[model samples]
Target chain A: AQSVAQPEDQVNVAEGNPLTVKCTYSVSGNPYLFWYVQYPNRGLQFLLKYITGDNLVKGSYGFEAEFNKSQTSFHLKKPSALVSDSALYFCAVRDTDRGSTLGRLYFGRGTQLTVWP
Target chain B: DTAVSQTPKYLVTQMGNDKSIKCEQNLGHDTMYWYKQDSKKFLKIMFSYNNKELIINETVPNRFSPKSPDKAHLNLHINSLELGDSAVYFCASSQDRGQGANVLTFGAGSRLTVL
Candidate 1:
């Protein structure tokens, strides 16, 4: 079985300040990881993914995440926060051992990030 | 044109009734999936179809049936809808189950409210 955890239920950060949303995973072999953002009454929008290569993956809207193998963590980070960045974020993982699959993702409960102006 | 689309973005129905959510993808993807997001914002996979063939069916109720008429279209039909079924249904698609990447393009979601 594969699973992900976003330990923080909610993160509060003031505008123009750096922000981080934490995520961790439990799985065997290599894992495919992703981050998605969802606004109220809207579907999730893809952010970034870590398949392999560089430990730090950059995504849209000036967002990036550092993949730490030792920590089993992929934390989303932004240099500066904006009020519009307030939303629910989810971390998901896919197990490659399953098959040549667009593997079924195991999602975390999601973390709500608030950027206060 | 939308890459992945679903009809009736909002569906309000009564318990014991049947309803269908239609999903279509134009990205030439060979794999499609249906996911349920509960009120608490928990996501779970209900079904997956690869090239119109059932691939993964989770521990979902038998009342929930998925129909894939073709590779580009996959529809979800719920029988005797229950209050527990009131949640957001998301339609997603990927290039293929074997393309190595599991990145799914999702629809806006169909909000199902069962009374």
Candidate 2:
């Protein structure tokens, strides 16, 4: 079965420092990867996606992810972290097999990012 | 206006009660989905509909029924809700199926607490 794994249960980073939340996926066909962030008691918001082309994908709220096909990893990254950037991050993937409806998303358990001042 | 919205953001009901959560998306997308987030914050896809046709149905309980009146609306109704049904439910919509890279627009999830 296709799935995503976020190894880090929690990542603590100091504000203004670089931050990285790791994600690895297992899929059968070409993978369409995505990153989403959720603040406390809020809905998951779209951050970025890797469909095709471009190994580095930039997204909203100054977030980006690097897609590595050989390693089957799509790690979320940020140059400088902010105190407000603390939230739960999820990595999801969908296989582009024939007749795939493109609705169901296999999501990771989520990584909690804590950017402290 | 919220692009995707789910009614009754917080639902507290007794076990065995039948309840329904209504969802509407104004993004003009062709596909809609329901995702369940467990107490551990693990997200899983429960059901999906494209243009009012059921396309994806995961290993969900038969008590959970989804109705898509149109492309813009997909409602979920649970019969004899069990205590294990307590979780956060999210409604999402995306463009047409087979769009290679479908970006989903999600609503503020409805928190269901079955006591």
Chain A of candidate 1 compared with the true chain A, TM-score: 0.97
| All candidates: CA RMSD (Å) | 1.4, 1.5
Relative to the real complex, the DockQ score for model 1 comes to 0.69
lDDT of 2 by residue, A1-117 (tens): 688999999999999999999999998788889999999888899899998899999999899999999999999999999999999999999866664646368899999999999
What TM-score, computed on C-alpha atoms, does each candidate reach?
0.97, 0.96
User: Please, what are the lDDT tens digits per residue for candidate 1 over residues A1-117?
Assistant: 789999999999999999999999998989888999999988788899998899999998999999999999999999999999999999999877866665688889999999999
Model 2: per-residue Cα lDDT at residue B68: 96
The stretch of ten residues in a row with the least summed lDDT in candidate 1 chain A is A95-104
- Docking class for model 1 is medium
After superposing the true interface residues, what Cα RMSD does each candidate give? 1.6, 1.8
lDDT of 2 by residue, B6-99 (tens): 9989999999999999999998898999999999999999999988999899999999999998999999999999999999999998986454
In model 2, chain B matches the true chain B with a TM-score of 0.95
- Computed on C-alphas against the true complex, the DockQ of each candidate is 0.69, 0.69
For candidate 2, report its TM-score: 0.96
